[model samples]
Target: MNAPEFKKLPGVLAFQRGLVITDALFFNVLKDSQTPVMVVRHGIRGTQNVNKDGDAEKSTAANAKRQEVSNIQTTDTAKLEEEAQALAVRFGLRFLDLKDVLFACAPASTDANDLVRNYRDSVTGFIERAKTSPGLDEVAQRFARNIANGRWLWRNRTIARQVEVHVSVNGTPLASFDALATPLNHFDNITDAERQVAAYIADGLRGDDDAGLDIEARLDFGVRGALEVFPSQNYVEDKPRGFARPLYCLGSPERAGSRNGIEFESTRTMGHAALRDQKIGNALRTIDTWYPSYAEHGRPLPVEPNGASLEAQEFFRDRKTSAFEFARRLNTLDPASPEGMFMIASLIRGGVFSGGKE
Candidate 1:
C-alpha cells in the first residue's frame, strides 16, 4: 500500500493513531505539518495556572505534592509551559482556556476544582438512583459511563458527543485560539452527534460513504481485542494504554508478558473509537507493512534463556520458527506432565495463542 497523503484542509485538524495526542502534541503536529487554521479547540487541566501575559506556569511544588499524595503522576510544568508557548508563537495561534469555559457555565462563585467535584458528584448520584428510575438515570448513567470509561456505548445504539474540558491554572490563553467569546454550543441543547455533523458540514466537509461504518468496525475490533502481544509481569503496568492483559498461569508461577512483539502499532487506536476511524485504518495498513520487512530480514528471536523449565526454554528458543514445529513440539510434551503444562502455559501467557485472536 502507498502512504496516504495527509489531507490539507485548512482549519480542520487531522490525527492519525493519536491516542496519546495531548494539546501540546497536537500543536506540535500542526507546527510540523505547517497547517494553518482560523481556530482550534484548546483544552487544559484545571490544576495548571497562567499569568495575565499568557505565560504558562506549573502548579507549585505544593500542588505536585498534593497530586503525589493523591497518587497522581506529577507533570513537568516548566517543560510543558515552555513548549506550549513556543508552539503558539511558531504557529501564530491563539488559545482559549476550555476549563474556564466549563466553569464559567457554572455559578460564578464555583471554584474550578469545585466545579469538577460538583459534576462528578452529580453524575455519581444519578447513577446510584438509576436502578429505581431508568427513564431519568438511564441517560445520565450512559453519559456518566461514557465519560468515566472514555468509550461510546455504540452497542447500545446510542451516540452522545459530550465534550469534556479541563484547564491548568498557570496556562496562558492565547488571543488567537480563544473560543470563549464565540461560546461553543452546548451538547445538552442538542444531540452531540448532531452537533458534530453540523460542525463537519460547517467546516465544508462532506460525508464519506463508509465513515460511520468504518468507525463501528474499528470500535468492534478494539472491543474484541486489537493487539497480538501480551505484556509480562515486569511490564504489566506498562501495558499499552488501551489494552488489558488478564493473568493466567504460564511458567512455574506463570511468567506474565506479551509475546507477538514489544508493541503493536495498532494498539494506539484502542479505546478512542470516537476519533476518525479512517486515520486508524491508515495506521493499520502502515503496520501491516512491517511483516514483509520482518520476513525478508528474518524476524529477530529472543535470546534470554531463562524459563520455568527446559521445555519453556526451548519454547523461547526462537519463536520465529515455523508454527507447525512449534505446535508439534508442544504436542510431544504430555499434557498431564508438569513440564508440558508449563510449556503450554508459557506459550499461552506469552501471546502465542493471540496470533488470530483479533
Candidate 2:
C-alpha cells in the first residue's frame, strides 16, 4: 500500500512582533529647554522636468514639451529654530516574551493537526535552546549597538557634529553613550557599557522578569545652529496638485489648505516633527549579516524573513534561508547557528505565515 500523503503547514499561522517601539518625537533643544519642531509650508518656483520611458530622443522630446508648462508649487519643510543648538529624538522600546510568541495557528484538516503540533513544540524547544545558547544574546547585542550608534537618526546623524544617546528603563537612567564613538558599519567593536545595555534587553526578551521592560532612548544631535531635520514622509497617492511633499507630524487632523480644488489635512497642530515607530524598529533590527551575500554586501540589512532590502530593491536570501523553510525544519536546526538565530530573530520581528492550502 502507498504511504499516506504528508500534511502541509497549517492554513492559518501568525505571530505578533515581540519588539514594541513607540513613535519617535522630534524636539529642538536649546540649553535646558525643549520645544517641538513644527512642519511648515514653503512656496517656491521650481522647474518642470518629466522624463519619458523610451529612448533618449523620445525622453528629450517629452521633457521639452512638459517644460512649456509651469510646475511651481508649495512644499512642506521642517527646520529647527534659529536659536536652537541641537535636535533631540525620543522614543520608547519594549519587548514581549518570546515564550509566548505564537499569536495564532488554525489547522485546516486532521492531517494538518500534526504539523501544528510540531510547530508549537518546536517553538518551545527553540526558546529553551536560546536560553542555553548565545543566539539570543548576539541578536540583543546587535540591537543595543544600533541604539548606541544612533543609526535611527538616518540623515540627521550625518549632519550632526556630535551625537549622544541615553537609555533609561522605567523612568530610571540606565546608561548613556557617545553615539559618534560607536562604529556604524559593524557590531563587533561595541564598548563594555553597551554590552551591559544589551544584557538588560536580552534578559527582558528571555522573560526573566515579570515586571515588563519599559526602555526609552533619546538621541541628542549637536548641530550648533538651525538646520533642516528629516522626518518620515507621508505616502499620499492622491496628493493635492501643488502640495508635492507632505511630512509626517504628530497632531490632530484638520484641513490645512486646498490647491486646485483638492483639500488636504495637516498634522502640524501638535507641532512635532517625528519619525514613525516602524522606521525606528527597522533601524534597530538591522542585523541580518548572515545572508548568503553578506561577504559581498558588507553592511547588514534588517532582519526580514525574505531578506528584503527595500532601499536596495533586492532579495538577498533564497528559499533555503527563508523563515518558512527554517520553521519547516526547526527540529534539525541548532539554535546557536546563524540560520537558527536568524529564524528566532524573525520570530521576534514577527508576521503572519499562513499556508493558503484550505
Candidate 3:
C-alpha cells in the first residue's frame, strides 16, 4: 500500500521487451498503467498517400501512397499474440490488443508536419503532440505505485480519477499463489552463452520479441542490469533466492505543498539487494550484438560520446522490443494475449525514441 512496504518486495523488477528500441523501452516502462494501449496509439501519425485510381478509392488509395503499411498477415500475428497470452495466463497476467495501440501511435500526419522545414519536426510532429497529454505523467505515477504495492490493478479505465483495485492490469504483474518456479522453462538442457547470445540477439533484432518467443535468453546477468528500473518483477526468481528487497528505499511520497513543486525524502532503512532481472536477456545480449554489427560498419561519428554508460546497450534493447513486437502484432489476426501486444502497441503509439539519435 506504500512505497516503503515494497522494501521487502520480491515480485517487482525492471523489464525490457526487445533490444534497444526506444519505443520498446517506453512500452515496458509505461505498459498498461493508467491507460490501455488504445489511447496511446491514437497519437501515432503517418504520411498521406495519393491513390493511383485518384477518385473512387481516393481515401484508401491516398493512405497507401506515401507510406505502405504492409498488409498484415493475420495468421502469423495471431499465433504470436495467442502464445504470449497463453504464457501470461500461466502467470496470471492479462494481454491487451495491439492493433488499436499501433493505430494510435501511427497517426495521420497533417499539412503542418509537411510544412516544417526541420527534419526532426517533420518526423517527430506526432510525437510532440502525444507528449502534450497530461496522461503521460499520470501513468508514470500509477506504474510506480503499482509495483510498490505487491499486486495492484486499476479498477477503472479513467485512470485520472481516484485509484481502484482489481479493475485493470497496468498495476498488476500477474502473480498467482502457486508453487511457481522461475519461468525459466524456456531455458533448457544444453547450455552455452553462444546459443544464448545468438537466440537473444535474434529476438531483440527482430521487429518484436512477440515472434519466436523463447525463454532461453532469460538467463544472463547483463540483461538484468540494464532493466534495473521500477516494477521489479522481471528480476524475481523463485522463493528462496529471488526474494530480495529494494536497494534504495525511499519513504512514502508527500506533496511539497508550500514549496515550488513536489519533493520527497529517501529512507535509509535498508542497505541494498541485487537489482537483477531481464536486463540480462536484452542488454547483455546487445553488447555482443554491437561488436559484430559494427565490426566493419559505417563512418565514425562526428566524435565518440564521452558518457560513462554504454548507451548503445540500452538503445539496442528498446529497438529490438519495438521492432519485433510491431511486426509480430501487426500480423496478428486475433490478439487474445495482453503482455507484448498491448505494451508493443502503447510504445509504438507512445512515440518513444532514443534521446540521442541523428
lDDT of each: 0.22, 0.75, 0.23
TM-score for candidate 2, please give it.
Answer: 0.86
In model 3, where do residues sit more than 4 Å from their true spots? 1-95, 103-247, 250-267, 270-358
- Write the candidate numbers in order of decreasing TM-score: 2, 3, 1
Per-residue C-alpha lDDT of model 1 across residues 81-155, encoded as one tens digit per residue: 111211111101111211111111222232333433343343233223322332322222222222222222112
Order the numbered candidates by lDDT, best leading.
2, 3, 1
Model 2, range 200-303, lDDT digits (tens) per residue?
77887888753333333344454455678888888887566666687888886445566545564433343478888889889888988889998898999998
Which candidate leads the pack in lDDT? Answer: 2
Per-model TM values vs. the true structure? 0.15, 0.86, 0.20
Give one clash count per candidate, in the order shown. 27, 0, 49
